[model samples]
Target: MEIILWIGFYFLTFYAFLPALVSRIFGFRVFTKGRSDSGIALTFDDGPDPEYTPKMLDLLKRHGAKATFFVVGENAEKYPEIVARIHEEGHILGIHNYVHHMNWFMRPSTVKRQIDQTSDLIKRITGTRPLYYRPPWGILNVFDYANLGYLQIVLWTSLFGDWRKKIGPDKLYRRMKQKLKPGQVFLLHDCGSTFGADRDAPANTLSALTKILDDGKEKGYRFIGIDEMIAVTEQAKKKNKSRQAAKGSEARGQEERVAERKSSIGPIKKIVVSLWMLWEKLFHVLFKLRPVGDAHFFNYRVRRYSGPPLDLRNDRTLRSGDHIMEIHFENQMLFEMGMKSKTSLQLAIRIIREIEKTLPDLARELAVVPKGDQVKALYGVSMIHRGSEGLGFETFELPKGLFARLTNVYLRFLIRVIHPTGNQRVREHSDTLNPRMLIMERNTLLEWADESRPNRRPNRERPVESSL
Candidate 1:
């Protein structure tokens, strides 16, 4: 608990107070300021708000100044007219993120969805893709850097807490004036999330922006946009590229040494790979099985069942000593009873036969109920399969007997030690018919079970981005 608290505290302090430092260290070199002579590039976040954006625009127009608005994608879609007007009025449209959630908390997929969706919407309306992205709350993770590599990341150099309601307009102006430096990027909020505390952000920020613009005009700080900031960043990167070029000769020598080392290890690596292949071949020979059409598919050829035979006639629990049995067969009747249809019973019988022919280990004690059924018991897990177009698999349960306890034990270990496979374990689907059960994770008989074959294909989810 204490460790968690410490981590949480550290995260809050780092992101809240040292965002630029964090970004710099994490390989996300967001522009915290424009060029020293470019004056402060003005930018607004979470806007084009109907109530305050038009008013803000009028103020900017009257002041004869230009600023960038990093508008949310959802809001942009909600009010494309406002987005179109922002583009028409000559303000730079940067993506502030689709939703106003903090960047630190979002997954890579969510971030991608947010940026791509928002950029597409803005581009559709304005015919220009966004070139700049300002992370919400100036907090970013490593994944954000990797994903947002194409766009220039912009962070603020100066912020006067305009979002806090307690900070009055005069104080806000004073704070901005105090931090007002050449090339400083100003952090000011023009809107807040609908899910968050309103705090009258739009109104408060308008007042602060007014004070800054007026004071900035008097102080001769030219209000620029992200383009200037991008120029500065690119210029620096170009210089770094030039410096790195000076080390290219040494880098080539290092690459040559690496190639020589790889050449030395190449023969030994091939020998090891050959040995592994030989060992795999031996295992296949032991099972009298071979890889079928696909390299992944394994099938057995023998049918007489020369492997260890299973005794399935008894439901009695084998006893060891002290009223303690190594394996219990009780309470597992839930599976036998769970088979509601004849098809399910048939599938179970087929799965057991496959196990008997292929993997003869746990098949030793396997059994099916009812002597008239031809098969005494079913072994292995029953995976759910939906009708033909595709199918999905759920968890695999153990069969009956000592191996049932052992299978349960094995599964418990898998659950505890091995990482969960999640939905990736299953594939294929059909929506027209109700789902049915198919046994997965079998003996050498896996290739014989064609229903289980559908689980091998990959499942592509619905496209996240919609048609514009």
Candidate 2:
């Protein structure tokens, strides 16, 4: 019996406690907080209370603030009018399970059913299914990661013990006030009827939240929904990445200028590169490109294509307005590599290795996006036309039009900017440096991910030159 009890303890630890610890400590497979400059996300749980929820809504409306409410399924079903009101008011709704129970105590299937039921209920009431979920108490089981891929699991950056009535409004306000900075996800309770919670605790929460909302407004903070907060965080990350890229380019340019003091065109080249980097920044901002996983070598943005139809290999044709993930090489990274390499061939080999390392990460990142599966192909135009077929890409000549001509000029300029010998290399290889479209269908990309193949050198028979 002693041995059996030990086995059960170990099993429970592995099955639940370990996973919960990983998620809480490292935020694995969970969105704990956001990165934004001017947005604050206020999220409430155990909500839709008959008395307190309406008051909270009224206070929020008066302050012109938006929030996210993770409502218990049972409570939401009972007071659906409150749920409807929440939707109508443009506040985000998230699932908080059917009851106030710990996820560690539930089976994987049971957790999935709870989420599905709650999501269906929300859809029926608000005509929109909720995409975000917060497990009760932010606990997780081992299977939660595998089972909940379709839903984004949210945690919080700040949690005050507002569910206890004795804390009162004054103390709660002070605690919440300390976390009033941008990009904070505040976890507060709006319904306090659960076990170990004071039933009237939410009354104090409401009172404290009213003051916090007014203070946040007066401080010029935008109280936004969690969805908007996530979007803003992504935009912030892109902006930071652009700035970092510009700094890197500047550093590289300075190093080159110092090394080649005899070259009178160095300062002029640096100015041109700075202007080019500014254009890249503007392009990223306009297109909203996202980095693939944590890899800075590649960024992509999904956009509707309005170009001419192109036939693909699998009896499929991509027509105008089809969604495609347009891929862009991180220009600074390429420029740095070129500055470090001795020749265009050496730079091309280094770029190939970097792509091999980053493609799998890009595949995994795309797999999680909501519209990722719907995208037709990964597409880009580059002067790196040679040896692309060896990397599972189909190459095509750009159509003769204004867009094609502009792309040709832009890519040729990029190659010169990133080449080790700059204009000398371009003059030597100008005939072969024209831009061409490189495309890999979604299915082929997924196959690469599924195989998880080891990186290999490109075919040596082909010219190993690329301006990626």
Candidate 3:
């Protein structure tokens, strides 16, 4: 029974003591200002003026509004009546520190005394204690011995620059209203920057106030006191903390699920890579077997190449990517072939042809390629013999059979000719050769003992399908 009684007493003591201790240490002003809704908090510093304060108060009253005033302690004592009017009119009174001293230069006790006197003076005049405090010149570090934060620090987002002598109502209004956003605080002065409150600064503030208040009211915004705004902001903070905790848990769960899925898929990627390599090599061999040109056709037109040499057969292998073959001969004959390959085989064939055409005598040495199903995606091809640079890899999704059309066009670009003496100047031989030019050219050295060949019909005019 005694233990239970002790625990209850402890709980009660902590509940009662913690907030006051914290509030006293951190200062109430740090936490207790303004709402975050579509409201503006207007705070005016250094005032309780008999001249401009009354005019400002009357303007606010006409507009049915209230503001916070951080008054100098001495000024409040001088115009106690004006302070009372402000209190009665429902504007919050705040301390701007007695003497507005640069407390950082003063001793600790002097700083305390400055706050004490202003606080006392404000309470004496208004009957209600001032809940807000503003540091002189928006500064706190210079006055280190003077501690503040009696209520929330009310910082303004908009300044009218009314303190400058040159500013007029039009300039002030444009400057202030341009940044008038929801949940902003605006700072102005009713007194002190200039003399007697009837100066340019105070006058400009008064002039700009009416339009600002009217515009805000029409936009469905209500001005909030600093304390109320702080209360709303705290409530929103608590709600956000709760929402973030829930989202964090959901994010954690999703991350775990994704990790598990990736673990399951590790092996499948390896298999696809293996198959693509094998198909690439097979096509590379086919490209080597295909003949390039025939010498018999040169009777009709000069054939630039006698076809890829049989000795270079073993030197050919598939490479990856797109390729272009440019054939240049000492005889001034030129051929250009563009072949795009999605597979290694197509790329190897085009490279081989390019090499053969450019350096027909050295085709065997240049045709060497690696054997295997391990070659990956190729992006480009280059041939040393022709100095031809190929571009736009196999990844460029051109239409099927486009490479075939390119090949035919390249072959036709170069004329066929038989230079028996291998000279640049050739003698005209014949005109018009049959389409069986490849057969005649290949069989030129073969001894055909059986002459039982069937009679050939006239050449058929079959249409070739469009490659692209």
**Index of the highest-lDDT prediction:** 2
**TM-score for predicted model 3 compared with the true structure:** 0.46
**TM-score for candidate 1:** 0.46
lDDT of each: 0.54, 0.81, 0.48
Q: Residue 134 deviation, candidate 3, in Å?
A: 0.7
Provide the TM-score for each candidate, comma-separated.
0.46, 0.54, 0.46
Off by over 4 Å in 1: 1-21, 24-27, 193-199, 232-468
Tens-digit per-residue lDDT, 65-102, candidate 1: 77789998878888899889888988888987898888
Error of 3 at 78 (Å): 0.6
Give per-residue lDDT, candidate 3, residue 252.
Answer: 67
Error of 3 at 54 (Å): 1.0
- Score candidate 2 by lDDT: 0.81
Question: For each candidate, C-alpha RMSD in Å?
Answer: 27.0, 22.5, 32.5
**Candidate 2 — which pairs collide?**
none
Task: lDDT winner between 2 and 3, please give it.
Answer: 2
**How many pairs in model 2 have backbone atoms within 3 A of each other, for residues 3 or more apart or on separate chains, i.e. clashes?**
0
